[model samples]
Target: MKKYNNLAEGPDGFVYTARLPLSSATLNWLSCLIRGHLKKIGSWWRALSAGRIAGIVLAVLRCDQRPSDLAGGNGVHRTTVSRWVREVVGLLAARAPRLDRALKKIARSGGGVVLLDGSLIRTPRRTGTETRKNYSGKHKCHGLLVIALTDDKGRLVWVSAVRPGRTSEITACRHYKLTAHLRAAGLGAIADLGFVGLDDGGPDADPAVIKCSAVPAQRKARRDYENRVSTLGAPA
Candidate 1:
């Protein structure tokens, strides 16, 4: 995580290390974007370049290392790395408006079908009241649930805010009003059996917003089709 001082330049440009997991061009672009935003804040730290900060964040995420471990590797204080991570997250959140606009445009163009699914991110087991809320019966672990949306090609388009592990996938989607947003953008959505009741709307409902593919009546056929859809809809 320490600044990659001995960077080797390939024919394409400066080469990123395996741990960083980004092309040099992409790193540079992200650095510029992050730097521009930091400059607007009067108290932004000037000790590290935007590229270095971004590299640290990427390394931590790719390796799934704790902030303290990342700081030790990067030869920086733990608090410093933690602050950098928070800043990077805030910067990305600030760009949501632009990201949403682009997604809406893509949906309207009918570029691909939207697939909805839920996943759990593991968390440490808690005690007392918190334990029940974070325990996931299906996963047999304590975690937070996240509903994700991906295009037909399996590219992530949107992700709902994290909910407790006990929260049903459909319930989370309703809280986020995901169907309304998709319908407003004139996009269709497909989901697994877990979202079976999603299409059941009143007389005023628009059926196109949620498209449930027919599951074969035969047990073997239904299982095969479910497996196929699961493979296709798996998040990238």
Candidate 2:
């Protein structure tokens, strides 16, 4: 991959931002497109100033700021920010480019590679949500199964969240199709062992091929590495 030792400057004499794989102009264009969509969705823009909502969403995405945390950022109430976040998540999930295209752009390749993995978000204990043990068997938590597809650089292209602890990785993945951008870029999906199930007479199952795990040595390090590799092998 070609590496840029320093950030590039734009035609408008503004310094380019670091960490974003896309160029400044491209990012601006994409943000504008997103804002345009938000405007059309029942005047979320009218409910709150466009700048405030945009700022709140960007803050949440960048700093993990919750709606309650925005009480001091601007005069906007926490409830307003929370509503914006929900609307933003829903819009982005439906309108964002497919994972494959975003990956190909970042990698600067004709093809794209995506790492599909799940994350857990803790849910309120009082609610009737499912709870599960930590993989390490340390504690219990309730949360959704989130599968994210990211490029080699770990930039997220797509994310899908499901009910707290309702299903395993393979089942959750079945709800999402390969992103359109990824499909256009001839992208490939990679996942862990929990996903290695046989096809269920579906067309989406054909591209994936599972490789079985080998017996592991008694040593903990070797056993862990083997387990990781086995999980990374494609699902059947």
Candidate 3:
């Protein structure tokens, strides 16, 4: 078989190179899942192969390529690519483990505190007051907020529901009652200062959620000390 990089088309235009930032095993797994989904939906066949449809979705997601660009390369309509992406995304989303279940699994495995993080998924800033709720003043951008937790090995175990961009990490956690969930699961978390006050009752009240309350100011002070040391050409 021709290598991925050497799949460019010639006069026949029957072959072309496409780059997907995922391994072959991942691609094959996704193709298998899509094929299974098609079987369940009573679709015996499609114009495009399951592998190709999987490739289109992976390109749009992992590679962050536009659907139109993928469509042109794959000889399909842009809407087809978009549809494939949505279908595959929904399929995979249905398989994601719930936060409580994921945390319980980690706890049973004798794992320690997990890492917590949050980020915004950027969206186009259209000129409309209706979209004001999506504007995040902290990041000075428009997007959706999402929170995630990873195991000790840095594998994602849980993800929070999508919230407005204006939402803070701590606020989202509280909204979801993440503290009660973590305490119930017997798991702890180490998060950045963004979640400083996540545990309203304080760390002692719920030691499951550890924060830097003892030396909160030390984070900034350490950074300032490092900058001064570098400027003075001395080690402090």
Candidate 4:
């Protein structure tokens, strides 16, 4: 197999073109954040440029490229790429605001309500008793249940901790004390039927979260709803 740069790489691999999928500004921001974090810990040097490091993490995160491929491209061990990914992800997670804090911010900004929804976050299946615990009868797969709150414009504001996928979304909200928090913040939530009973529409319940219109109880409708929710969290 012969290799060429332009029309073809050869019988072994074909040449292809792609866009970065993220803006230059986003890449630069990630690089700066990583650099600042390293500096704060008194680390001085890295084999790859901060921008390049950001690119590697983004490729794996955004493009779903494999770590082994990324390692080969950068001439580093696969473990090194994994480590960088862990580091970057941890840093970003730490910076995300807590649910209460985000709610307060939205309230202060004069926002009336937030959109709340639950998703079945996909997870790899493991053998044993754990499988039954993580398995969702609705989706018929193993995953975690996660509640997410988004602004009216669909921007993510907060996400709940992972729970067993078998847990009902309405039950998950109660566990999180979401209604109390929303009331305290003087905010409401608009949720899908999964959270139909999240708020009782009582007169005393100020700024009550409203549930969307109910879907039919037919088995096909139920399955369709579950399928749509599962797809929202499935990896590309």
Candidate 5:
């Protein structure tokens, strides 16, 4: 990777550049990390090189572009792009254990706090039993539920398996046994009001390990206190 040096001042008083290169050190480290898993197998011609395949995956994930749109822009068939995406996903899945260990090391070394939250990923509408399972009353859309745990710096540490959209955030956490995992890792977690009961000092709850802010009430002072707590608990 090369350093970016083409920055220019625009009319709007903002500096702009065409390309930003990754640090050579970082690129080399990443290359060495994935080199073993990205080995070539059968002697067959490939339309896109390994670099291009990685670029396609990053664009789709970071830019949130559709496969068809990316295919058109890259002058490749949609099926080819889709296949590359699946291949990259499988490669990452296979390396999940290594990734988890790395994150655990960081958490333990730094004694960093973890932030737990649930998000809904939109999906196409479905019929029959699927409709009931994937419909989110809160978002008024069909989606999948995913619980993510991030470090205090907002870097993702772990993500739970997808659940139906209708599942509450707290329910999903329980289903995934996230509390035990957090306890085992010896890391504290901060969650939003949606996980109210999680830190309520119940027989199964560990208030010290998992803390959550109280939901805002009708009174103005109560709402202000809740807001302050939320602000304090939010990850940097």
Candidate 6:
């Protein structure tokens, strides 16, 4: 009987969602991942005694606020908050190699999906690059090339971000290389149009791999009609 297990109304007009058993399971998994990182860095003892650095970092990832706001929320200084973020980046870099093998094992077990997509993150105003603009369609805004992979139901699994808006989506895809990992692990992948044609005759492309298409069709009207029909029949 968890105290917060039942749904309630929030101060805002929206519903307060109940935390599912799966949410707890996922949090436990995330805790394990953080603990593993602390152990690898030989800071497990420090992490346990020095306060909830990993928890704050996770909160930053989950929340809509800035890092400073996250720090305040966790009752730590902004610099300490930034350090926690840095540690997360370091841990991810170290763990990325391990992920390949783990993904392969998961794929072998069968029936998973990897969704790849990108979104624009505006440049920090303090960064000098913010001044350099590109004018193609609208006023050229400096943006990040963000790629993320998720399960079919949209649970985030992996993420990568790069600066320089000119960085090709295909290059970003190849660099992250989740497709091969998913295939090896027994997972399917769904990617948008930017990732289409990547498998076409490049030295890096693998023609044999199977990936689910999240890519938009060239015939937009027909695709929209089909999409409406699919949405209507989708299980509630």
lDDT of 2 by residue, 93-123 (tens): 7776654446556446533346667776655
Per-residue lDDT of model 6, residues 1-236, tens digit only: 65766557554333222222235554565667777776777874642333355455556666534677655555557887787677776766766535465555445544354456775566643446544431112225556666666555676666675545656666766776655664445454555545666544456643312333454455664565345433322121
What's the TM-score of every candidate structure?
Answer: 0.74, 0.53, 0.81, 0.79, 0.69, 0.53
**Which residue pairs in candidate 6 have backbone atoms (N, alpha carbon, C) closer than 3 angstroms, thus clashing?**
104-185, 107-185, 107-186, 108-185
The digit string of per-residue lDDT tens for model 1 on 1-236 reads: 68877757554343223455568886787688788887777557755778887878777766676787666555678999988888877777766543355458666565534778899999999989989998998899999999887777787777766799988888888887776676666555777677877655566865433434456566775676555545433221
User: Over the stretch 21-46, how does candidate 3's per-residue lDDT look in tens digits?
Assistant: 67999989999999999999999977
Q: Candidate 1 clashing pairs?
A: 2-74
Compose the digit string of candidate 4's lDDT tens values, residues 33-72: 9999999998888878889999999998998888987777
**Which number leads on TM-score?**
3
Which residue window of length 10 is worst by lDDT in model 4? 227-236
lDDT of 6 at 110: 48
Candidate 3 structure, TM-score to reference = 0.81
> What lDDT does the true structure give each of the candidates?
0.70, 0.54, 0.79, 0.81, 0.65, 0.54
RMSD of each: 9.7, 13.6, 10.1, 8.6, 10.7, 11.5
Clashes of each: 1, 5, 0, 0, 0, 4
Query: Which has the better TM-score: candidate 3, or candidate 5?
Result: 3
Give the best candidate by lDDT: 4
Predict model 4's lDDT versus the native: 0.81
Q: Which segments of model 6 are wrong by more than 4 Å? A: 1-51, 67-76, 97-103, 112-114, 129-140, 151-157, 161-163, 175-189, 202-236
| Candidate 5, residue 12: how far the Cα is off, in Å | 35
